[model samples]
Target: MRSRYLVLSVSAFLCFITLCNKSNAQVKLANLFTDDMVLQQQDNVPIWGWDKAGSYIAVSTTWDKKIYHTVTDASGRFMVKIATPVAGGPFKVTVSDGKPLTLNDVLIGEVWVCAGQSNMEIPMKGYKSQPILNSNEAILNSSNPNIRLFTVPRGSKTTLQQDVKQSHWLAASPESVAKFSATGYYFGRLLSKMLNVPIGLISCNYAGSSIQAWMDPETLKAFPEIKTPAPADSIKEVSRTPTTLYNAMLQPIIGFGIKGTIWYQGESNYDNPAQYDSLFVTFVKILRTKWGMGDFPFYYAQIAPYDYAQLPPYNKGGKYNSAFLRDVQRLDEDKIPNTGMAVLMDIGEQATIHPPRKQQAGERLAYLALGKTYNFKGFGYQSPAYDSFTAKGNSAVIKFKNAANGLTSFLKEINTFEIAGPDKHFYPAKAQITGGSVTVTSDMVKEPVAVRYAFKDFVVGDLFGTDGLPVSSFRTDDWDYNVQ
Candidate 1:
């Protein structure tokens, strides 16, 4: 009797183990493929996931009614490139691995990746004491079904991750939009209304993260100084460890198709302005390579003016020229192809790092994407930039590109102009608009060798393009800050 009982119990246990194994053998999709997701229109969008080893997986789209097939590798990974239709979708995508899994309410539209630090992460509700311009009204009006939002979970990892742990697509409503990235939401909203199509914005941001935090390990190898451990700070709380955020955040969704990325970073990298241009350019290159897209549109916002002079003593005396970082950002646009910058010379706050006029910044970024990427007609996307400067007897006459429609000055007199002599001592100068250019003269510097406009830690410029875009901050000289 005892032996019979023992044999029966052992048989039942083995049967239970078999059932569990069978249940766990189903296929899984990437986190980005949840319901209400948006795929880039008119591109080869990649659908990838994991399944039982050696299993055959098939994907079918309701729009085309065509099935694409691939087999899982020995390690259980499967990927297939499927062509997406143009600019419209309320479609369904079904993937089968012996069982069917369907994603409904999917969209095919223009998709943008919105990335950066605190400024980009700031929501419609704003942060701390800095409020977004007209946030209450924007939130109340945020009931758009055509716009989709996704926020990646925050984490830091020592190694690269294949997938996000948890994420979901949320449609824009008052409740959802209030917590969403205001800059990203406004940018997408503008694109949707102008293009008359769906828009997808993937908000991937980590506040107070340096550029190194978003770069892959291979990219960080090129900048050995960034790899070294930062000196300890007891008061400040954030981590400056290299490649942690990239491993945790960026790697997971790299191959997901995106029209481009609009960035609002650089505040954390302000202390080390010297390496910003090369680092930023290399970061863009690495992303393009990983995404398998060659030179797609890369639009970014210049760091808004902030009084970093008030940064704590532990921050290396806290005396940094944030203007230098802004200059580097503009230099990136000149050096990198298919790149543009949104100037924020008039939108920043003097006492706060977070700027309230994120709406304008977001709209300007959208203008770049709309005019340059989609070729929208009559869109004056490029801001006025310093084109040519010739020294006269005691003044410099500067010409500008993208000022053909003419310029506008807010105040009675144009401000923030500076002139420097051979000694490199910059002093305030008188500036006046003449036709499509500005003439600057300084009584302090008689033989002015260089000109700088809005080149301070905090400044508000009056010069604007006829299209209503602010002129970019600029410095004509390459002199180091400590040269004098």
Candidate 2:
């Protein structure tokens, strides 16, 4: 009887160990494929995860009615490529590893990732209450079944995440669009109208997030000269440096092909505008390299004007009236290979940080993508950028590169010009267009050495080219400020 009991106990222990091994060996899909997920169309959609070594895996989609199979590598990683359906779906994906794991209610559509700072995260409902609100009527009628949205909840960490805690795709309707990102909703709507295809927007933006938070740690560490040091306490808490929000939000979706990226940030990095030129180029280079797509359309909105204070001494940090950020953006045109900037100096509000004019912002971004990426003819994509400036006595003559059909003023008068002598003391100046160049002079300064256009935190300038695109803010001086 004792021998029989011993044999039974050993057998039970062996069975339990076997079951545990099998459970650990099985392949599991990421949380992104759970239910009501949207996959990018017209591309090879990748579904990957971890499993036991040498295990066979199979994935089947109902919308396309296709099945794909693969085997786990030595490291237990397995990837299967499946062609996406033309239209959106409420379909299912079934995965088999001896046992079955099914993902229900998926969609195949135009998947776009909307990223930026506070302005991009500002919802439509917030804009509805503002003075310059313009999209209330459009929001009321925004019930499109072909459009879907998935918002990544805001989180901060110094580690890469295999999956987001909570995020699910919802069909875009009047109620949904109102709560989603206003700029993202408008951009998606325009794309849907143009292509006549279903659109999916993945909004993963955080207000007050720095550009560094969206960059990989390795990339950031590789260029320590460019990296801003974090708080000492935060550094010592963890042996491994904290991965940025971009790693958590963007890394998981890297292999997933996206049409393009629409960005509207730069406010947080305004304090150190000098290094922004190099930082912006580095960020774009790494993003393109990681995505495996060379020079895809990357469009961004220039920082709009807003009042820092109502008093004088605006040149202290140079923060109040610095064109440094815009200058860095302008430099990107020459440095970065394929990129576009939508100038918004004309549309910004003087009092509000969150601008209410998102319709024009999104529309302009779409216009650039349409012209540059989709090959839309007769559409103007470039804005007025600084070409060259020459000093002519007490006045400076400035030339622009994208002065399409010549330059014009939005108010039909010259405004928002400032000239400074060798002392760097700037005074409000008057400007007038002469042929393709604008000559600026100020009565207060006898010998004007430098000229600045739209250099205030908030300027009432209407300077634009004949094409109606606003001229970018610029400064001819390399003066350093306390803000640095």
Candidate 3:
């Protein structure tokens, strides 16, 4: 009886071992390759997965009917780049390496990475009572097969994840658009209308996330003050913890083909506004490097004005004004190439941090991509940016760029302008729009050493180009001030 029992136990053990081997040999694709997905059109888009070690993997697309082959490495990781055709598909893709896998409703078109904090993550249905403008109307008209959307679930980890959890792609419909990012959805809607191609927007964002949270440990080597999270450590604020989101959320989706990225964040990083300039540029550089994409268009929205001091656990620090944060983002455009900023000067709400004008924000970002990136003509898409200032006696004339048809105050008085002398004390100035420049003069300042426009924590800007895009808040002086 004992011999018979031992033989039975050995047989059970052998069966378990065989099951494990079978599971390990099955081919698996990355999380981004599921149904209703869009790949960048006419590019060698990467599709990666794990399979049996050293096995030959073949991937074929219905549109091209071309089979791309590559061999798996020793670790069982396989990656193959398949050439996609131009912007049209309701296609099928299949992969095999002894074990078969398939993805349906695949699309070949423009793809964009939409990321940032709460503003970008806020859905079309909006938050509670704080509603997005004409959201219901937009949602009712959102049944389009050409628009594809994917929302990456929020995750924070000490180690890199190969795939996203609880995530999949869905085509645009009333139900899906209502839950999708308001900014991302609007941006996609505009692209689909203009380019007349399928648009894919991958929404990966976390609420109240700081800039540091999206940065990897290696990318943040220049800053020693930030500590890396250990696996065993208890992290209470996962969104605020550096390198956590980068590991779990961003690292997995790297190397996916994309036309560009659109960002809307910085409210969380307002307290450390000065360091954000460095952090922003570094993050963009690292993302560009990791993706192997050469300087793709990086467009972002300047966080709109809000009373920062009114929020809970708020710092009364006078220098914590949000304008500094906006300026840092504005300056980063010149520091990095192929980048643009959407100014929200006229769309802010002084009381609520989450501005209700998200559609405007989204459409503005689309304008940048349309004009600068897609090279659409016969439309003024850029805001009038402060270029240079020349002093003539008591008045200072500020010239602007992107004002080919000239600047306009639209019959409204430019009350947001201020002039300062060497003392750094600012006084409200009278502004006159002359051609592409604005001449400012204050009776108090005999010699204007500096000029600022809409530079307050919560002020509306009236200056604009003939295209109606408002000028961004700016300051000529770097002198620090306490706005108490």
TM-score of structure candidate 1: 0.92
Ranking by TM-score: 3, 1, 2
TM-score, each model? 0.92, 0.83, 0.93
**Prediction 2 global C-alpha lDDT:** 0.72
List clashing residue pairs in candidate 2.
158-242, 158-243, 159-243
Candidate 3 lDDT, 1-484, residue by residue in tens: 3211111233443443344354446788888889889999989888998877876666767885666666678888888877888999899988765455788999889999999999999999998978898899999999999999999999988777878776889999999999999999999999999999999999999999988889998877898887878777767788989888998898899899999999998999988778898999999998999999899989999999888888867765556788888888888888989989999999888888899889999999999999999999999888989999899999999999989999998998899999998888889999999999999999999989999998878877799999999899998878875732
Better of 1 and 3 by lDDT: 3
The TM-score measured for candidate 3 stands at 0.93
Give each model's whole-structure lDDT: 0.83, 0.72, 0.87
Ten contiguous residues minimizing lDDT sum, candidate 2:
1-10
Most accurate candidate by TM-score: 3
Name the runs in model 1 displaced over 4 angstroms.
1-24, 228-239, 314-319
